[model samples]
Target: MIYCGLILFIAASIVHLAFCALKRNKAADATKVFLMPLLALTSALALAPRLPESRTAFVCTLCALGFGCIGDVLLLSVSEKRFMAGALSFFAGHIFWIVQYVFSPNGTSAYAWGGRMFFFIALICFICYGIVLASTYVLLGKPKGVMGGGVIAYGGILCALNFTAINAVVSGINGKAALFYLAGSILFFISDGVLSYTVFKKDIPYSRFIIMLTYITAQALLAAGCVLPYG
Candidate 1:
C-alpha cells in the first residue's frame, strides 16, 4: 500500500511538472494543489510504523510537511501577497524542522562533533550565503527593507536546517535519517533559490523543470527522512 502511494506521489508530481512545462496554467495549478499533500500522506504511511525516535518527532515532521503544503498552494496563487504568504509558510515549516531536531537526542550530535569549530564554521557559511543572497536581491532591485529582512531570516533558518541535518549525518547517529534530511534540505535550498530567481529576476531557460525537479525531490526525500528508523 505504501509503495503504491509512493508511486502515485511520483506520478502526480511528474504530471504537475509536465503541466508546468507545457504552460497549462490551470492544469498545472490543479496538479500543484495535490503535490505536497501526497508527499505528506506518503511520509506518514512510510514512517508511522517505524517507531520513530518519538511520536512528537514524527508529528513535528508531519507539521513541517503540512506547512509546505500550505506554502505550495499560496505560491501558486496569483495575488501579490501570495509569494510572501508562501514564504512565511515555508519559513515556519523550517522552524518545525529545527524544533524536531532540537528535541531529538541525536539532533544535537552535530554540536558535539569538533566542539566549537563546527559552530564557527556553520556561522561563517551562514553569513557568506546570506551575503550572496543579499547581493542577488539588490541586483534584482529588491532592496533591503521588509522583504529583505524576511529573506534573510528564512535563509538563515534553512541554512541551519541543512547544517544540523548534515551534522546528524556526521555524528554517525541515524545515518539514514540524517542523509535523507541533508539531501532534501540542500535540494530544498536550491528549489527556493531557483524559485526566487524566477520570480524576482529574469527567467532562466528550463527553469520550470529545474525548480519542480528540485522541489518535488526535496519534499519527497525530507518526508522519507522523517520516517527512517532512529538510532
Candidate 2:
C-alpha cells in the first residue's frame, strides 16, 4: 500500500512539473504544486522504518522534511521575491533536523569528539562563505530582479545544516545512507540554484521543470534514507 502511494505520488509530481513547465505563468498555481509533494511526503512517512537505535531521530527528521515541503511551497509562492521569509522558513525547518541529530547517538548519546566539533566549525565557515556570496550579489547593487539572492543564501545554509545533521547520524561510512543523502542534497541544490538564477537574473529557461523533478527526487530520497534497514 505504501509503495503504491509512493508511485502515485511521484507520478502526480511529474505531471505537476510537466504541466508547470509546458505552460508559462501556470507555475503560479501554488495549491497544485504544494499538494503533490505533501502527499508524497505523507505516503513516504507511512513506510518509514522504525529502528530502536535511531527511531526518535528518524521521526524528527521526517517532521523536519514535512516542514520543508511547506517551505518549498512558500518559496514557489513568493512572486515578488521575499527572500528573507523563505529563508527563515527553511532555516527553522533545518534547525529541527539539527535538533534531531543533536539528540542522536553521535550528537548526544555519545561523548563529544574534537572531530565532530571541527566538522561543525567547518560547516559554519561554509555557511559564512555562502552568506558573503549572497551579500556580494544582493546587498551590493547587482540585483537579479525578483529572485532575491538572499533567499538562495538562506536556502544554501539550510541545506548545509541538514547535510551536517545527516553526516552526524550517517557518519559517511554507510554507502546507502550516504548516497541517499548526497543525492537528495544535490537535487535540492539544483532546484534552488535554478530558482535563484531564474528569479534574480530574469533568465527564462526550462529550469522550473528541473526544479520540480529534482525537488521531488530529493524528498523521495530523504524518506528512503530514513527507512534503511537497521541491524
Candidate 3:
C-alpha cells in the first residue's frame, strides 16, 4: 500500500510537471492538489501497522502533510491574502516537524551528546540565519510592512528547522532517517527561496516547474523520513 501510494504520487507529479511545461494551468492546479495527500497517505500506510508505538510520529506527520495540502490549495490563487494564508499554513507545518523531531526517540537521543553537540547545532543555525539574511537582502531587497515581517519570521523558523534536521544527522540517532530529514529540509528551503524569487523579484523562466518539482520531492522525502525510523 505504501509503495502504491508513492507510485501514485510520482505519477501525479509527472502529470503536473507536464502540464506546467505545456502551460496548462488548470490541469496543473488539479494535479497539484493531490500531491501532498498522496504523500500523507503513503506515510500513513507505512505507520499504521505500528499503531500506538508510532502514535506521536504518526500524528505529527499527518498534521504536517495536512497543512501542506491546505497550503497547496490556497496557493493556487494569486491573491496576496490567499498567499499569506498559505504561507501561514506551511509555517504551522514546519512547527509540527520541529516538534516531531525534538520529541521523537531519535531526537531525544541527542541529549546524551551534551554541550558540544548543542554548540555545533547553534553554530549551524547561526550560519543558516546569516545565509537567509544575506539572501533576503541580495535577492528580494528589503521587505516592507506586514508581509516583510512575515517573511522574516518564516525565514527564522525555516533556519531553525534546517538546523534541527542537521542536528538529527549529527546525532546519528537514526542514520537513514536523519539523512532523509536533512536533505528534505534543505530542498524545502531551496524551493521556498526559488518561490520567493519568483514572487518578489522577476519570474524565472519556468519558475513554477522548478518550485513544484523541488517542493513535491521535498515533501515526499520528509514523509519517508517520518516513516523510516519507525518502520
Candidate 4:
C-alpha cells in the first residue's frame, strides 16, 4: 500500500511539475492537490503495522500532512488573504512536525557529548537562518501589519523545525530516519526561501517548477522519516 501510494505521489508530482513548466495553471493545481494526501496516505500505510505503539507519532504525522494538503489548496488562490491562510496552515503543519519529534521514542535524546556538539552547530545554523529571515523580510518591503508578524513567526517556527530535526540526527535514536528528517527540513526551508523570493522580490526562472519540486520532495522525505523503523 505504501509503495502504491508513493508511486501515485511521484506520478502526480511529475504531472504537476510538467504542467507548471508548461504554464498550465489549472492543470498544475489539479495535480498539486493530490501530492500531500498521497504522501500522507503512504505514511499512514507504512505506520499501520506499528499501530498502537506508534499512535502518537502516527497521529502527528497525519495531522502535519493534512495541514500540508490544506495549505496546498489554499495557496492555489491569487489572493493575499488566501496566501496568508495557506501560510498559517503550513505553520501549523510545522508545529505538528516539531511536536512529533518531541514525542517520538527515538527523538531528541542526545548524549552529553552529542548534545554539546549539537548545541554549537545549532547555534550557528540558527544564526544563519536568522540572517536569511531578516533579509527576506526586508526584501518583502518590510510588510507592516499582520503579514509582517506572520512572516516572522513563520520563519521562527521553520527554524525551530530545522533545529529539532538536527537534534534528532545527533541524538542517534534512529540514524537513517533522523538523517531523512534533517534533509527534508533543510529542503523545505530552501523551498520556502525560493518561493518567498519569487513572490515578493522578483520572478525567477522556472520558479513554480523549482518550488513544487523541492516542496514535494521535502514532504516525501519527511513522511519517510516518520514511517521508517527506528534503530
Candidate 5:
C-alpha cells in the first residue's frame, strides 16, 4: 500500500507538471496548485508509517509534510507576500529537520561532522547570496514582480533547507532518514540547477517540459524524504 502510494505520488506530480507546461493558461495553474497539496498529502501517507513510533521521528515527519504542503501553497500563490510567507514556512520546516537530527538516536554521530556541516552550509549561503546580489542589477531593471532582495532571500532559504537535509544525511544522524533526505536534496538541486540555467543563462533553449519534469521529480523526492524511515 505504501509503495503504491509512492508511485501515485510521482504520477500525480508528473501530471501536475505536465499541466503547468502544456498551458500557461490560468486554468492550468489553478489545477496544478490544487493538485500539489493532494500529491503531498498522499506522499506523506505513503512514507509516515515507516518511521519508529518515537516522538522525534513522528514530529519530524509531520514537519516535513507540513512544510512541503506550505511550500506548495506558497508557490501556487500569485502574491510575493504569500510567497514570502511560504519561504518562511519552509524555513521552519528546515529547522524541524535540524531538530530531528539533533534528537536522533545517533546523537553522537551528529557531533562527529557537525562543524564541517555548518561550515559547508555557511559557504553555500555566502556564495549563492553573492551571485544573487550581483544579478540584482539586472533583476531590478526588469518587471520581475518580486523584489530582488526577496528573491535572494527565497533562494537562500531553499538552499538552507537543502543543506539541512544534506547535513541530516551526511552527519550519520539517521541512516534511513538520511537516505530519503539525500535523494530529495539531489532532485531539488537538479530542479534548481535547471531553473537557474533557464533564468540566468539564455543561451540554452528553455522548455517548460523539462522544467516540469525536474520540478515534479524534485517535489516527489521531497515528499518521499518525509517518510521517516526507522531502520
Candidate 6:
C-alpha cells in the first residue's frame, strides 16, 4: 500500500508539473489540489511500519498537507485577500508540524549528545531570521500592509517548520527522512522569496516558471519525506 501510494503520488506530481510547464494555468490549478491528498495517503502508510504506532505524526502530517492543498489553490489567484488566505493556510500547517515535532520523541526525546539545546536555540534563530527577512522584504519589496503581514507571518512559520525538521534529524528521529523534509523546507523558503520578489519587486524574466519549479519540487520532497523509513 505504501509503495502504491508513493507511485500514485509520483504519477500525479508529474502530470501536475506538466500543466505548470505548459502554462495551462487552469488545468494546473485543478490538478494541484489532488497532490496533497495523495501525499497524505502516502504518509499515512508509513505510520504502520513500526510496532507502537506514531498516530500523532500521521494525523498532524495529514492536517498540514491538507492545509497545503488549500494554500496552493488560494495562491493561484492574484488578489491580496487570497494571498493572505493562502499564507494563513500555510501558517496553520506549520503550526501543526511544530506541534507534531514538539511532543514526539523525535523532538522531546533527549539524545546522549545533548542536542535539545540546539533545537531550542535554532528555533529562536529561525524566528529572528524571519523577522530580518520580512523587514528587508517590506523595505525593498514594498508589499502592502495585508500582504506584508502575511509574508512576515508566513516567513516565521516556514522557519519554525524547518527548525523542527532539523531537530528531527539531530535527535535521531529519521535521519534520511528528516533530510528530505529539511531540503523541502529550504526550497519552500526560496520559492516564497522568489514569489514575493516577483510579485512586489521587479519581475525577472521567467521568474514565474522558476517559482513553479521550486514550489513543485518542495511539495514533492515534503510528501516523500513524510513516509521515508527511519534510518
Clashes of 2: 2
Candidates ranked by lDDT: 3, 4, 1, 6, 2, 5
lDDT of 3 by residue, 1-231 (tens): 888998998898999999988889999998999988888888899999998878878999999999999999999997888988999999999998888888876664446647686787788779868977677856787778888887888888788788878778777767788788888898998899989887788888888888998898888877777789988
RMSD of 1: 2.4
Output the number of the TM-score-best candidate.
3
What's each prediction's TM-score? 0.88, 0.69, 0.95, 0.93, 0.64, 0.82
List model 6 lDDT by residue over 49-158, tens digit each: 65255766777778888888899889989887887788789888878767766654554344543557785767687777867676766655556577666666677778
User: Lowest-scoring 10 consecutive residues by lDDT in candidate 3?
Assistant: 105-114
How much is the lDDT of residue 104 in candidate 3?
A: 77
Instruction: Name the top lDDT candidate.
Output: 3
Evaluate all candidate structures by whole-model CA lDDT and list the values in order: 0.77, 0.58, 0.85, 0.84, 0.57, 0.73
lDDT of 6 at 154: 78
Cα error, residue 40 of model 2, in Å, equals 5.6
Ranking by TM-score: 3, 4, 1, 6, 2, 5
User: Which pairs clash in model 6?
Assistant: none
Candidate 6 ranges with C-alpha deviation above 4 Å: 48-52, 108-140, 229-231
Candidate 3, TM-score vs. the true structure? 0.95
Q: How much lDDT does candidate 5 score?
A: 0.57
lDDT by residue (tens digit), candidate 4, 195-226: 87776668888889989989998888877777
Lowest summed lDDT over 10 consecutive residues: which window, candidate 4? 106-115
Model 5 ranges with Cα > 4 A deviation: 24-27, 34-54, 106-109, 113-146, 173-180, 186-211, 226-228
Output the better candidate (3/6) by TM-score: 3
Location of the lowest summed lDDT over 10 successive residues in candidate 1: 105-114
The residue-level lDDT of candidate 3 at 26 comes to 95
Comparing 3 with 4 on TM-score, the higher-scoring candidate is 3
